[model samples]
Target chain A: MNFSSPLTPTPVAIVVGASSGIGEAVARKLAHEGYAVALVARRADRLRALCAELNARPGAAHAVAYPHDVTHFDEIPALFQTILRDLGRLNVMVYASGIMLPSGFSEYNFGKDRATLEVNVLGAMAWLGQAATYFEQAGEGHLVGISSVAGDRGRVSNPAYHTSKAALSTYLESLRNRLTRKGVHVLTVKPGYVDTDLLKAVARPFWVVSPEQAAADIWRAMRRGKQQIYTLSRWGLVMWVVRHMPSFIFRRLRF
Target chain B: MASFPSADRLALLTNFGHSIGSVAYVYRPTHAEQIAELYRSAAGTGFTVGMRGAGRSYGDASLNGGHVALDLQRMNRILDWNPGTGVIRVEPGVTIGQLWAYTLEDGWWPPVVPGTMFPTLGGCLAMNIHGKNNYVAGPIGEHVAQFTALLPTGEEVACSPTQNADLFHSLIGGLGVLGVFTSITLQLKHIYSGNLKGYAWASPNLRQMMDEMESLKADSDYLVGWVDGTWGGSGLGRGQVHRAHYFAPGEDPSPAQSLRVEAQVLPDTFFGLVPKSILWQFMRFFMNTPGAWLTNTAKYVHARTLDHRHHFLQSLVAFNFLLDYVPNWEKSYGRGGLIQYQSFIPRAAAAEAFADLLKLTQRRGLPTYLGVLKRHRPDKFLLSHAVDGFSLAMDFKVTGGNRPALQRLTDDMSRIVLDAGGRFYFAKDSTLTREVVAESLGPDTLARFCAMKARCDPQSLLQTELYRRVFGSI
Candidate 1:
């Protein structure tokens, strides 16, 4: 349907790394809210499956799967442009994807740390870089990056993972500050433990939340145009204590 | 090798029941040329190919066991739209839900749609789906102005009512046995607004339910019902009769009428889908037959009080697709998934046919998981399911230890339906045999369809597992 009579164009949103996990849920939720979604992910089958499920719902809008790997930083622009061309408009860009590997300083693996930074920091920056420019030019849009609660405080156990998220968090904040005056809202979504296959190993999870719940919280925050969100609400308090704890005491803590 | 992309080579498909199938390959083709190439290659390799759209057919209709399956879901695109003419052209992968989403804003909607909106337009055409108002609107094929199909021989054939009429009719209900539908031009139904004024008439017996349905058929713009199939004795088939029509612009809706907003299109109204968490999937484990029976009974009782006219004004979404109120609602059926069996019986034998169908399940203590009844009338499509009668659809939970019994139950019910001058819808049917299919369709219609199939797909490259399972006699 043409949005000619309406002041705004058709609402479009792009979810990078939507093949599975939280990114898939966010894409589905947004499509349910009448936003035409462009699902970007490396696995074409998963993306296509998710897109098909979204479009098949009784009250759904269009969802097209754009097979892509955000790690391929150079191609992010082409991906966004294709979304604009195929979906007709752009209103939201959610970089809700990253890579994490568990390792202590003693057993630190070279490749894991390299990939962690490449995806969590450099890859996110590359994708958000394109989103920030496009939204600023459009004069209205929402840019979101799913950072982690781990970013609030550095941990000795996984320095690279923590630092990569911290960098993503800082980058998102910088983008928010710069884009705020341009009417483009940038949101940093930080979640604690989410039940996702992305984890390298499973543990008895604490405050374990599902991706759909995380997506819903993020969706609510984005709708309210909130600058940052700590999913599950309780995670906000948990992160607050982690952020406010004395440095010496925190250094000695094994948490 | 044409460089088929696959991090995991086998693209497996699972249904609502969580039943999984691993195929030789899965390809998401962007164009018909890709399908032609695939068919050409399959011919060379002697690998039977099947076309899949959405893969929501509840069974293996879209699955190709030990063969190559083409995933066409990614080909969805609304190619063209003419608001005034209500004629829209879309790729075969375009879904019925998507068709309504695009056209509803322009006050146009597809004339025929199944209960759930998950099935793709191509899938619906392949099944020739009928809706609540089938008695008046006919099957989806009637609303299709034309369609293009990529035959197994690599021929792209365009067919419509006046052009390639034989292929047009056969393809409507040909399953994937004809070929892959490439692009479709559909004629949509026009509506004044998204609002529907409706009411539910409560019935206490099968006789009264069918009687009320017969009387209401001529008056209602749209009609469907929910049957309490597990209710035994004289109260068998007791349920509610749903009737509705699009409210004319500026028409005054009664205060008693509940307002429903077309989901995703309009803002939330008094009637809207409640939010659910990810936990809902795991929580649906309580969806057993007994659990379903309790819910169904409660729903039926609640519906009984709203007899006569509530004068409710509902959004098209709330009326036609009330099933979507609970997101991923089918998951409630739990790990086994929901198996839907819908039977269409000529009005002359509906009373006896539906009674026997329900009684068989009731005797076995299998709750009809979900029972929906809709009035139907015939269309000219060669393999059409509607037959100037009433069609009743019921779901059976395919949980552990129930598959064997369910199979037997389906066999007994199929025999009863066939004997009572009733036909089965291939889309919802998973167990109909080749002999039953020939008997149900009659000799002439079956023979003609086979001849057409031979003419178009002589090598049977387009034939799927479901086609062979249902019509192997051909």
Candidate 2:
């Protein structure tokens, strides 16, 4: 019952979408916390900047930038192997690489929705499956995936992004159920409107949280061994109401 | 400087304690973006996570093994320092000592500071430490303007009183259960000179002390007292109180400013010291006995007559002279160790509760060591322990069979505190039944906490001993 003691250090943490936004923050946090961080992102400049920052620390442990597109399955083995080669071990993999097509589902391009599915769903699965194999072989590992609060339920606008997150959440949940006894961990994180570039581009009114605050929430959920959590706790209540609202009353209002 | 394997490989290589080994991985992100990436990776791996700021918390409040430990020390940078308005924006790693050195020169001091000087602003927010000034300034949370945290969803969010209010409330005293705190903006209070308008008073009984404490709460800016708990009969629970105020700016600085004058008391060597055997004998008999009154009374008079504040000696050093002289004195307790039982009971029941507490201690014949009582104000910050009541903190040195007796006393006292609708402070806790914690701090709060965890960290990535004891494993 005492949670004061945690398991052990992870050899390597492969953070997807380490270019910017929440991905970049998690990468920095993990690397600083003693994980040999593998920064996975497309923007080489930004990743290199982060690597330099981590390396510049007076007694920094280990961190590096790996420019790999999550959408490319062929990059998984090499990207992960490179982490093992450089950091000496691999234990945690985070899927934070994501893109949002903000336009209404009806107005957005069909191709954009497909790309969202491909990058968020298919691409995440490719890397996550590889991570599962790595952890299963070692008999211990953790997999973290980032989802959106929009995934709590369907919305009139941006149905594709919401659907992608909701689907991702379900996939992680199912994966956790399967891996619960295998020493492999799967976590799904759902955040409300984060004050990231993507959310900043939208016309959000009431629910907007800063990236740092969001990171703190993520850190807490992970620390408490919580299977799931909302980045901002109140969003759970908001979702509760949204899920239970009467159809007649709900259909008339716009969130 | 000590290096260990990653969380996964740690079990294979070394043996760590239940509390010490919980750190699976440790990350120190310089920027907020990197923390997001760490969250992303940790979520997929299902590794629990925790944040550490200077790691000054005496116990395991900041440690979580088999999980990632986020170190915010490297991020110690002053993002903004507005000397004009006394508002400072700093990373979570900024230490109280660092902040004090910077602002004290400008005639300002941190509104509150715990006994230790090395704790960080983030740690302060996490524990919500209160000082003697708690009666006047309230807890550290009330002065916080805003904080940015990195969440498990790889989201970087900023929360303040006006924005994301729930998060703001939870993070203040949530014990890092919510997230890794990054940067914080806090409002510093204006101060005059470092001189403290000091007054020393003695109380003959618990009621007299409580009466003086009630008055001190309203009239003084900083107040604290030392109780001679060993006193029994008419002198039982008698003590001395010290109240201090900030000297006005234009007041004469000569009397308050004796440059290097107070250094004369600094001990160059242990020329004459009390031996362990003698101290043990004293503790065994006269330590908490009525005969100790004469010794304590003389000690107070001697301490009161010390040279007042001087130019060279800073306020921080001047305020804690007693601590400087006796270092690690607690080790004198032999191997039996000790436990500090601190409680907060509503002001209405304080007199009777304290009287009952003393009687119980006396009946048990346990050493009624150093007892301190202070006044506190009510606050709205979630997880805040402050209440409009009287808080009593005592350190009991244990002997051979005293542990159980202490536990029983604590349980009885906890019952009184719970009955008065007050809660125990987490930072100074080793006891306090889970049921009591649940009852005192509504079980619904844990439900809400669990539901939030269920939604965000469905993989149960975070785990701490305290969480396991109070909140079951996911």
Candidate 3:
């Protein structure tokens, strides 16, 4: 979580969905790592506050505040243009903005599910596409998409959120393919249960990772040029067991 | 308009693995059926498919331009891990980093990992990546119990030393020519902590250093030496030799116990990667008289004198994990990038040929920042790069204007290697000619590789740009 204290000469980072949860933590970590971060979120006030706090730090005067909803695809272009105008070139872009709706399979809410899909899938595509455009032009950049271990396999409990993340994961994979030749690295950051606001409304486990630790893992994955990394990497083994559960025994078990 | 998906970028490197290209497509096939479907679709079409694991390769070996680079990153599912047997089966995309991350926390460690811990199991098997402990553990192919390879003929065949032995041997170091490796089973090592009882020694000259390395090979579990590449004459090869041995079980384990350690702090960061201009300027200075030799000797003496405490040092995985800090540090060399020249010379001829190689480095005026010398055990795999010899791996930061000179140096070094029956590691190759590859690896070995390719991928569907380099288009 305190990954940035020892390093200097921060790179320029663009964090989409920096209002809360993993996005906020990523923005903070990137800034701490000496990156001149551009905070992009829906709420202008929240971003401004984060930027102010970053600037207040010993060596974070370069942190910039840019509030914009990632779902607003039409506004993404201007956002990048502004970023380039203010900061020159972007080296890292993290898409941590997402939403989750808790509901059983039988009693699904279309409205809630659609909203989750919008923020998690469509929003990711729009922002990622924008990032890809810049990376292709610059011929080098890193695109990190915050995903979840749940995306590994669709769970019956949260089908909508699972499907959206799974799709986003695939899209990032495709984007990585196109961008790799251009020297652009695409990373899919998949975390397990985390102590974040998004999971607050749902039932959670006691062993969930803290926001800082999750951010650290994401940062480490990007540094390693890992295309798709399981945060805490151990979670990959846990999810492996969860994913390979036989349906007969799996359906009988309760979460 | 053609939509180049990310998964399809691997094919671009099928024609010339070293050529400049961008990743345009990537595919992740979680299931075997998906991989088979991809293979079938690309069978007749001219589209190339290159398998991509962790992008740890220093050269263009893993890159494929204008084709789908099938990224198996998501395929990293551990199918089975038997602690009692030390056999772990996983998808081809699982990397050594993941292996260590998952297993080391549980008191298990991978026996071998190259300088970098980012390559996938498939990439390791394909490139036959070796490590510092190669003298003890051998190349990655030796640890691999078996693998399921996807041939261009769209067949899923499980190969092993005892089963489909030829395919298994050819596929391991075949550089992905045999087919797409979907899964691999390997033998894992047991470990107590991330600490090592290690020591470093300073050698004065090349002959003395070579003799010291040979003596250490008799007893050391892990051995690697840092050589002064810029220095020539009888005093050349002098630097530091590091020898590490794992404490016996239930013996002297570090008191400090932690499953996960914090990230190792780096001298730089992503935002402040060393500027290309600065590196070029430094290279110019380092290439001048008394620059590299003096600096390297100083570093060697200083490093050799470090106090060894509990050595609560990072695990082999973390110790080698530099990229985890400066994410884009490689780009510090800029667009033209740099090249790594790693060659293996028979231990008998190492003293002479390595001396010649060092002389060439001085003659060509190549600024080699790092010179790594390792003692390797003879390998059993057909296309494996490790030989019963001394291997030297060095990084040359190429200035675009001086590329031709670097190539000339490489060509001369390759000739010395060919004459000495030494082989060049294809994984780090960017300038090795087809003839050098054939001469060094042996014509029969190359013929066997060609025969296997003809048998499985008659139309040359099982291909890589690396294959096209030494063997031409099938």
Candidate 4:
């Protein structure tokens, strides 16, 4: 279907974790749809590439690369200010930056698990929190972040990763509760088996969706102003069973 | 001055074929000054530069190896639009499809667009692409009022019919050489309705098909024929000619019905509802020689069975972008992919040229699937592929072992086309020899083109794998 939007000055979308995977695709996709995109990521090189690719599309709004690590949450305030100063406006904040590492009970590493919490939970809180506040002040804006289906269940393989996502999902819900009173919309995106660079070494799953598709789903959910969504139809079903399963059955089943 | 995209940012890029290249640098400059800055930077780095639109070029035309490639898709914006005159100025990255999408509601359309609407406006002008109505309207370049070409030395020169006339002619079909097209202002056409009145007529042979195409051209504003290449004897190169005319509101009973286009999405057919990659794989196998021939034959036979012609009113999208529904379907052309060869022969020599072209491919056992024929009149866009006659385009699946043999087959076909007084289009050309190019355009044309380049881009900053392949680097 032909997509139509008002022919006013373009809106701005700050896409964090845009250096790779879903964020990269979102930055490009939003730029094509007339959203001036500011790409944020830790890797300057990757963000630069994505920024170049997005900027070169004809009739598309501008895309700029802003390399900033989410782990260094303090820097985001200045980064958002610079984005506002340059792009003139902000309409959406998409936080797809997070880390995950597989650690079993015997081999659990405190540093790796703590790093995941700091990046996924603390980082999301700082960045998305600021976006929530800004958008609430502006009276209209969307705040979207990538949580995971792992949050639905405490997985033994990567408990830290699951806990971080669950924490993130709760933080987003609480933010949404507070922001709804004011004019901000918060969306939590939970993806299952997304074919990203992070999943390259893993066995190919039957329903692994591409980052491009994942980005499209997330953008669609954000546009529809959904509070939360499980990307891809099969994933929604898969997550449903996982989320609703009796704790007695869930604990016994090693996943 | 703004910096160009770094080497780390520029990974190997691919288009249709197996050919891939890693540009040392890739840049997306939003303004003419930024593009000028990129050129200056390339000079200092001792690497040449090339322009890449949507990277729709099937071959290496847009691929730059071991050099800087300027990705211009970001410099896209509607610079100006005069609704009254139908003159719209757009950045190079805007796709022809976008132009149509935005303008069709206003009952206006770009005068010329290639079969697919994905290619950028700048690339279309560079290739001087032709539409089905080429016999009457000429190429896209003719509709272009002017464009700002950023020269290598940070000069943003305006090239049009009346200004910088030499550079204008050379740059028209200059294949992204001379300079980068930063801005383009085009004249659009006005149509009474969004739908086209069309029909598919079955032709028994190559000669009859060309005749049918000519007849269709005379009456219809847009004309294209699909020639089947499977059968060898009397039915050789036999196919269906699909002719169409823009509905003149008066003739169409419900002209106002199409004031707004119907939903662009196709309903989920049983097969379409399947996941995309699986559907793409299915289409690939479904388009193999035997399968495609059967479908084409069935279509031809089915059309011939009818005593009276059946006319259908179709939307512009239904007519032009029928292939777009199957996204990434070309990937199914096998792991190696396929190459599309479109040769333009003078109308007088077309019938004879087609026989030889058919014989060459048939004898080589190269399956010429998806054959398209179109009538055209010549345009003065120096590198324009349109001829004062008609052209036939076909896609040949490329196999690993048959690639060399396929090149030989194409080389032989090139000789036949050149002998019949025809030339190749650079956009689909991955195997065009320099000798044929020089022979077709004459040494004077190439020398003149090179002279313009040398004078404007002294450092030879603008070069792509296409330039290196078709024309040796300076």
DockQ, 0 to 1 scale, candidate 3: 0.01
Q: In order, what lDDT does every prediction score?
A: 0.77, 0.69, 0.73, 0.77
lDDT of 2: 0.69
Model 4 C-alpha lDDT per residue in residues A1-255, reported as the tens digit of each score: 111111122578899889888878888788877898989899999788888888787777788888888888767665665565455456889988877775665677889989999988998888887677567545668999899887878966687888999999999999899998777889999988787776753444567889899889888888888999887767778888888989888888867
Candidate DockQ values, in order, are 0.01, 0.01, 0.01, 0.01
Ranking the candidates on TM-score from highest down gives 4, 1, 3, 2
Q: Which whole-number lDDT from 0 to 100 does residue A168 have in model 1?
A: 93
Range of the 10 consecutive residues with the lowest summed lDDT in candidate 4 chain B: B1-10
For A149-233, candidate 2 gives per-residue lDDT tens digits of 8787777777788789889998898889878787777778888877776775477546777766776776667766678878788
Please provide TM-scores, in order, for all candidate models, with all chains considered together.
Answer: 0.62, 0.56, 0.60, 0.63
Worst 10 residues of 2 chain B by lDDT: B12-21
Candidate 3 CAPRI grade: incorrect
Query: lDDT tens string, model 4, B90-139?
Result: 99999987788777667678998887888899888888878888898888
Residue runs of model 1 more than 4 Å from their true location after superposition: A1-255, B1-8, B19-24, B249-274, B277-286
Cα RMSD to the true fold for all candidates: 16.0, 22.4, 21.4, 15.4
Could you give candidate 1's per-residue lDDT for residues A1-255 as a string of tens digits? 222111122478889878877898898889878788888888899888888888888756778888887678867755654455344346899997787776755877878888889878887888888767666655668998999898999976688888989999999999988999988999999988888875545345688889999999999999899989888788889888889999999999876
**Residue B122 in model 1: shift from native, Å?**
0.9
Q: Is candidate 2 or candidate 3 better by lDDT?
A: 3
| Clashing residue pairs in candidate 4 (N, C-alpha, C atoms within 3 angstroms) | A55-B74, A56-B73, A56-B74, A57-B73, A57-B74, A58-B93, A58-B94, A59-B76, B49-B461
